[model samples]
Target: MPRERHGTPPVGSRPMMSIDGLGDLWDTLFGAQTDPPALLVLITGAVALVVVSTRLPWRIARNAITIAHEGGHALVALLTGRKLHGIRLHSDTSGLTLSAGRPTGPGMILTLLAGYVAPPLVGLAGAWLLGGNRITLLLWVAVALLLAMLVMIRNVFGVVSLLITGALVFAVSWYATPQVQAAFAYAGVWFLLLGGVRPVVELQRLRSRGRMPASDADQLAGLTPFPPLFWVGVFALVNLAALLAGALLLAGPFLTDAGLTL
Candidate 1:
């Protein structure tokens, strides 16, 4: 017979807090737990942060959104069989995604559109995971995305930004208490959900003044019969729909309690 286990198990068998055990901790912290009020507060706070950031031009607060934007283009380009050349991030909250492909084709059109749509789509996915109390999954997913972008970073700022962003997500996922991870994940999801809409409005304003040429909206207009203004409207509509859907998903428990679920 094997010896009786002592106060602690063997090294490999011990209940260690490794990456493999992240699920266990996440479950312990948020599994099957629904705190609607806290979730709402976090989402509201995230929206406020983005609103304030919009007022402050060229702030570091906006870089994360820019990274997500450019990364979106790069990702779609690769997915559509385009060769990604590089990505560059600027301090002015602008970014460029370089890829080798037909200049005017379906691939180009999709790559152009991906930047504006990525944030809200990512936020919606995050909200879905949060609704199921999958906080660890959210953090790890963020880390994976940041890392993927990091490999495509072709500029100093891009590399630095991606590294810092990846490190934060990794730190939160690997070391932070589960409650803290959950809170951060909620804030991040809300920020992405809300941050996507303002840019579409700004793009329209720029286009009206003839300042934005060759923008994603303008490129979309060239590809489709719809005008640039119409494409902007479509982007706005998508972001708004994502926002509303994310909010409802995040608040599902509360809505169910209020007999509002359909």
Candidate 2:
């Protein structure tokens, strides 16, 4: 019989598969984590509120909202059977998504309407996931969306913004502890819920001042029988409803644990 070589496995002895390793990976991706303390959840909400309310921080953080906003347009465009050309994110926290289809139709209307409503809807979804203790799944899903959005970015700033955001989310998902991931996910969802309202408010303000004549609301108005202000009101209503619903989902557990009713 031939001698076994040094550092090699003995004859007919193959490396065994690691059931423990696979179990760990599955748990990391899909397992439910312990709910974070109520105080931490409230603190994250407060932090997100500050970012949305403050001027300088909002100027920077609004980029994330812009990503979701444009992504909404892109998604709706595709769903409506339109051809998406590209998307651009500017440094001013404004973005544009280009798609080609019938110049006037329900598809076009829905695509235009999707931008302002997307963030809060996304936040509500995230809140639902967190309510189920799928914190890791939430972060991973965000990273996946960002990666998918990266393919349609049409400008330098958009690419840089997406890459940075994706990197941060991926880092947290891959390396952070469960507690940290939960906090980050909660903060992000809170931000989206709160942040979603501001843009509609701003849209109306800009429209009143005649500053943004070509805004989504204005475009929707031109396409449909409704006026610009009407569309703006629609956006406001949807976002506010989403905020309220998301709040209940996120805070209901804490309230219940405290023996309080909302």
Candidate 3:
């Protein structure tokens, strides 16, 4: 990817708050070439990978299960007299276990619900949080996770909640420049919400429309028109967009003054 030259944004080269300037923050000394063509290549490559993954059936199913599984672990811990430790998401069904004694029957039931409750709530919160700059994204997510953990402090998993929050912030900070990091930060926040919030909202809407409970599978059965192909298209577009954005900036384009940008 074309990287920004290592210096403050050049005088009048671009607006500090502009998208081009923000995008330029992804500039690097690690073989970064500011040539418009190279920048376009990086954007295209990044977009393709992301879109393809999103459209995969396995990926979607696995993420769905992961959502539930996280809740399960928290719920089970609560019921079993085990301290609810923070959840760890893998690429498959959740493993709801605690670091302490096993719970009785009622405890098992609570553990199950923990997984269920977390996803939707977390998602709903995320949608509202990601509407701004990188710092806003980071702070919003951190605050949300920390607050949620605090509410569940009696659970053993509370401590790890902060750790998880820290990890995300670190990931974005380490890999991204101010602008690119901000973009990923926005996506990360939305990903949490979409995984939980959008699904629940859809479920509610479905129920209201049909006057019957929607039968979302506990297993990986949810499917819509977005297939592997859909993801490919999305990534392709993102890369194109990235190139366009870069070109516009290099050619002296102006970004909207609004504080939002990818």
Q: Return the TM-score for each candidate structure.
A: 0.82, 0.91, 0.36
What lDDT tens digits, residue by residue, belong to model 3 across residues 30-146?
222222233432353354336434647335434443444354456546556765544444323323333334333444434433443454344333323322222444444554444
Kindly give the stretch of ten consecutive residues in candidate 3 with the minimal lDDT sum: 213-222
lDDT, residue 28, candidate 1:
56
Report the C-alpha lDDT of model 2 over 34-146, residue by residue, as the tens digit. Answer: 87899888999999999999999999999999999999999998899888888999999999898888878898899999999999999999999988889999999999999
Report the alpha-carbon TM-score of model 1 versus the true structure.
0.82
Against the reference, the lDDT scores of all candidates come to 0.77, 0.90, 0.40
Q: Could you give candidate 1's per-residue lDDT for residues 15-111 as a string of tens digits?
A: 7578858977766545544454555545665664656366763266678778878888988888988888788887688888888877767987888
Rank by lDDT (best first): 2, 1, 3
Alpha-carbon RMSD to native, per candidate: 10.5, 10.8, 16.7
lDDT of 3 at 217: 22
TM-score of 2: 0.91
